[model samples]
Target: MIPGMFDYFAPSTLEEATRLLEQHGPDAKLLAGGHSLIPLMKLRLAAPRVLVDLNGVAGLAGIEERDGHLRIGAMTRHAQLEASELISDRYPLIADAAAVIADPLVRNRGTIGGSLAHADPAGDLASVMTALRAELVVVGPRRERTIPIDDFLVGLFTTALEPNEVLSEVRVPSPNGGSGGAYVKLERKVGDFATVAIAVQLTVRDGTCDEAGIALTSVGPTNLRARQAEDSLRGGSLDEQSLRAAADLAAQEAQPAADLRGSEEYKRDMVRVLTLRALRRALERATR
Candidate 1:
């Protein structure tokens, strides 16, 4: 179905876009890559009276290195992220997750900010960002604010962003010493949404886990940081026994729901299995 009729405004700058949103209020929607929003609009779930296209906005599409973090423009496409040498070298988990989002066609058009703003529980980027503890920069009529990834996602298809705010960039801290990360998902088919997804980041020192971050997706109302699992690994050697115990805690902490993709029980099981596999792979990479 076609989207409802709406006034289209392509703004050349973020200030203009935010002004449009302020003017239109709840009746306005910001259009980025439109991979996610357009579908909702076409389905009539979202019928904004005005579409503030951000494509024309300058300075919203690039990857840059700052003092100690990689700052990705909100409009940066998944395909771009996959192709970024910086990301591949320092944040391989992000690159891996980007490569697995839908198919090539979707990745070519989908924006990272769009994905995070949409806050889809099944989205790969959300879980990866959660595990990475990424920061989101948002601008609004009042002022600009930085939101932690954990606080940014409030619920399924929901976020902490105010209606008049636009997500400007995502900031990922550079990987610490001896750190490696990986994302693993169990999909029914290629390019399908994950039935269960896991992201693991480990900082190992002398064969002992100095730090660990774990997140699970598509198994809860929101992407969940596996705090219990991470806590289990910290200060311990990632031996087979400890890994198994952490995996069990990860599964226990999951709050999956019964859905068409899989039952909650099955999803919980996948969380356990995938968490173990991802952690093992991440550990191997860190060692190497």
Candidate 2:
């Protein structure tokens, strides 16, 4: 089905976009890549009165390094991220996740800011952001604020963003020495959302784990941080026994729902399997 009739406003500046949003309030929606919003609109799940397009807005589509963090403009396309030398060198996990989102056509059009703003629980990029402990920079009528990844996702298809707020950029810390990350997902087919996915980042020192971040998607109402599992790995060697124990803890922590993708039990089991695999791969890379 086609989306319902709506007024379009292409704002060349953020001030103009914010004014449009303030004018329309809840009746206005910001259009980025439109990969997520357009589908929802076509399905009649979202029917805004006006679309404030941000494509014409300058200075919202680049990747840069600032203050020890990788700052990505909200309008940066997935395809751009996939080809970014800085991203591949400093944040390979993000490049891996971006490369797997849908296909070439979708990646060429989908924007990182749009994906995070949409806050789909099963999205691979969301899980990676959670594992990387990224921060989101948002601009609203009143002022600009930063929200951590842990606090950004509120629930399925929900976020901390207020109706009039817009995401401007995402800030991810560059991986330090002895740090490595990986993302693993099990999908029924190419371009499908994960049935169960795991993203792991580990920092090691002298063969012992210093810090670990584990995040799971498509297994809960929101992207889940496996805090218990991460704590289990800290201060321990990345051995077979420790890895298995952490994987078990992660699987137990998952609160997956029974859905068409798979049964809750099946998803929980896959989480165990994927967690172990991701951890092993991350550890190997860190050591190398």
Candidate 3:
């Protein structure tokens, strides 16, 4: 389907882009690897008068280690992350989610910033970023500010970014030397959105759980932190019984709606199952 008539601007510089955005305000939409926005435009679900294409901006497309963290450019594609040695070696959880996002073709073109800005409750990256404690760097008219992952995403299809802001980078804190992470998802089919998705990061030391980061996707209005579950595992052995107890607490926080994915009750149960599975695998990787 063709989109409605709209003016397009591809500014080669960041300053120029921000000025354009400030001029156009809410009527303008930033187009960054347009896999998400293009579909919405085709459906007429989004009808912005101006499309400010970010492709021309040079600095927004790479991954590098900076200040003891992985600083990923907002424009980096999912396929890039999936194949990156930096991600595979240090953050397998990110690689796992990136490899399974949409499909090969979609991953080839989908940008990290676009997905994060899209803020779809079911997207794999949002939940993974939450568990990883990632921070979003957004640039606006007067200044650039960093927002933590959980604070950046406010609700479904919404974010804390103002209309004139551009997400420039995503900074993920480096995991401790003995820590590891995992992502587990239950999709109806190979390419479908997850029925229940779980992301976990565990830091184990001397046969005890040091820290845990747990998050849920597709079961609420936003990507949710499993704080209760995380707290339960801290300072305890991550054995079967402890995992079961944490999973139960995580499941209790779910507010899923009945849909084609499954009944509400069914998804809640899967939350328990997947949470346990994700934590176990995460612990194995960390302990090795």
Candidate 4:
């Protein structure tokens, strides 16, 4: 597939990128890993007249833990996240999703910022970010601001970012003792998007849930937090019945669409099953 002819600009600095975007406005698309934009462009589903490539923009890749939070540059690739010892040790939920984002080649080329900004409902990272209550730092020509994951994701292929803004960084808090997180996905093939997936972060203390975060993927117009399910798990001993109840609530909150993957009911069922599995796995990895 080939994309339409367009003017290409590979800006080496963020300020330059922003300037290009501000100048081009809605006619321009920022190219990160090019995984999402390129595909859409090739399909003619997107036709930006200007391509503002961010690939050459330095200082937008890497993972660093600082000030009790792990800060990830937007240009960081999935392969890097999957290979990072620091990410594996501190935020396995990220590493877990990174490992399965696509095959090795795709993983090497996919960037977290691109995926998040694309805001595909079926993508795994949005749910994981929501589950962790992560924040994104967005920069524009006028100002900079932080957006919570829930607020950042508005709908399918939509976000709060202005056309002139760029997502610069992702920030996640350090997990305390007894805190554990994991992501579980069900895909039809090795590189397919998830049919139904779940991301969970749970904190336990004295055999009871101290905190819980649950989010579902490919289950609604946008990836969403399962707040009722999360509330159901809090202050309870994570036993068979409690887990089942919480998992069931997650399914109830889901609004999955029927596609070739399966029926809506089947997807809801998968949500229940995967939610339970993810919670169990996260619990087993719980620290303290």
Candidate 5:
């Protein structure tokens, strides 16, 4: 299907891009890697009057550590994250999510900002970032602001970003000593969207869980931060009993609907099983 007609503008600066969006208002859209938008446009589900291409925008494509967090530029490609030594060494959860986001073609062309902004419930990074409690930075005309990942994702296909704003970066807290995380996904095949996916990060000190983050994907309107599950693990030993209790809470927290993937009950059970597996894996990594 051919996309509807639209004017295209390649802005070399983010300010200019935002200015174009401000001028064009709701009729304009920002073009990142175009993996998600282009398909919608082709199907005539979206037809913007103008496209502000962000590829030419400078200073929006890098991964680096600053202060106490890892700053990931909005335009950074999934393949870049998967291949990054910094992510591999310290943020293995990010590496795991990056590696499973579709095939190489999609990974090479898709941008992290685009994925998060699209806000698909099944998006891998959504669950991973939620578990990390990442922050999102957005730039608008003459201003910038940061939003927590939890607040940034408002609903399915919706975000806190204004139409005239550009998501500029993602900031994840640097893992401390004794901290580790894991991403566990269940899919029918390679490159398939997850039926049920779980992301877990744990910080253990002296054999006791000091902190924990548990998040789920493809189970609700948005990536769910399993707060109940996280709370269950804090200050507890990372033993089979505690892990089982937390897993049960996570399963209860999931809101999977019956679909071709499986019955709702089946997905909820998978959540319990995966949560247990991920917690153990995170604990092992944290203790090592």
Candidate 6:
């Protein structure tokens, strides 16, 4: 299906792009990788009057570590993340997600900023970012600001991005020697969206859990934070019993509806299994 007719603009700078977005208002859509928006447009789910292309904008793509944070340019490709030594050595959780998001074709062209901005509940990157408690930097015509990933994601297919704003970067605290993370997903097949997925990040210090983050995907209106599960692990020993309890809490927290992937009961149960697996992997990485 062909997308509806729309005017296209290739802005050389972010400032110019934002100005175009502001001028076009809600009818303007920014083109990043176009994986999300183009499909919607083809299905007629989205019909914007103007398309503002960001490909020409410089300085919107890179990966760097500075000021105690790992900064990923919004336009950074998933393949880049998957292949980065820095990400693989320090933040393997991100690499895990990037390596499995859709397939090679999608990863080759898809952008981190585009994925998060799309805010699809099933998007692998959203849950990963949530588990990392990453910060999102957005720029608009008037100002630039940072929003926590939790707040940036509002609901299904929704985000906190204003019409005139562009997501500029994602910032995550650099992992210490004791910190580790993992992403565990259950899909029907290769490149399929997750039937149930879990992302876990853990910081272990002196045989105790110093920090923990647990988030779920494809089981709620948004990427669901397993707060109770995280709280259960924090400041506690990662014993079999504690891990089981946290897994149970995460399953309980999921709000899955019956779908083609599986029944609600089935998915909830899978959440328990996956969460336990992910936690175990994360703890091993943290301690080893």
lDDT against the true structure, each candidate: 0.92, 0.91, 0.92, 0.93, 0.95, 0.95
TM-score of candidate 5 to 2 decimals: 0.99
The digit string of per-residue lDDT tens for model 5 on 1-288 reads 899999999999988999999999999999999999999999999999899998999999999999999999999999999999999999988998899999999999999999999999999998999999999999999799999999999998999999999999999999879999999999999999999999999999888899999999999999999999999999988889999999999999999989999999999999999999999888888988
TM-score of 3: 0.98
Superposed by TM-score, candidate 6 places the C-alpha of residue 10 at a distance from the truth, in angstroms, of 0.4
Q: Taking the tens digit of each residue's C-alpha lDDT, what string does model 1 give over 1-288?
A: 899999999999999999999999999999988998999999999999999999899999999888899899999999999999998888888987998899998999999999999999899999998888899999998799999998899998999999999999999888778989999988889999999999998899988999888999898889999899999999999899998899999999999999899888988999999999999888888888
Off by over 4 Å in 5: none
Tens digits of per-residue lDDT for model 2, 1-288:
899999999999887888889989999999999999999999999999899999999999999998989899999999999999988777777887888888889999999999998888888888898888999999988899999999999998899999888899999887779988888889889888889989998889998999898999889888899999999999989999999999999999999999899898999999999999999988887888
| All-Cα superposition RMSD per candidate | 1.0, 1.1, 1.0, 1.0, 0.7, 0.6
Candidates' TM-scores?
Answer: 0.98, 0.97, 0.98, 0.98, 0.99, 0.99
Q: Which window of 10 residues has the lowest lDDT sum in candidate 1?
A: 172-181
Which residue pairs does candidate 2 place in steric collision?
A: none
Model 5: worst 10 consecutive residues (lDDT sum): 279-288
Each candidate: how many clashes? 0, 0, 0, 1, 0, 0
lDDT (10s digit) by residue, model 6, range 236-266: 9989999999999999999998999999999
Query: Which sections of candidate 6 miss by over 4 Å?
Result: none
Q: What value of lDDT does candidate 5 attain over all alpha carbons?
A: 0.95
Point out where model 3 deviates above 4 Å: none
lDDT of 3 by residue, 75-155 (tens): 999999999998999998998899888888889889999999999999899999999899999999899999999889999
Question: What is residue 135's positional error in candidate 1, in angstroms?
Answer: 0.9
Put down candidate 4 lDDT per residue, 61-151, tens digits, no spaces. Answer: 9899999888999999989999999989878898899988978988899899998999999988899899999999999988999999999
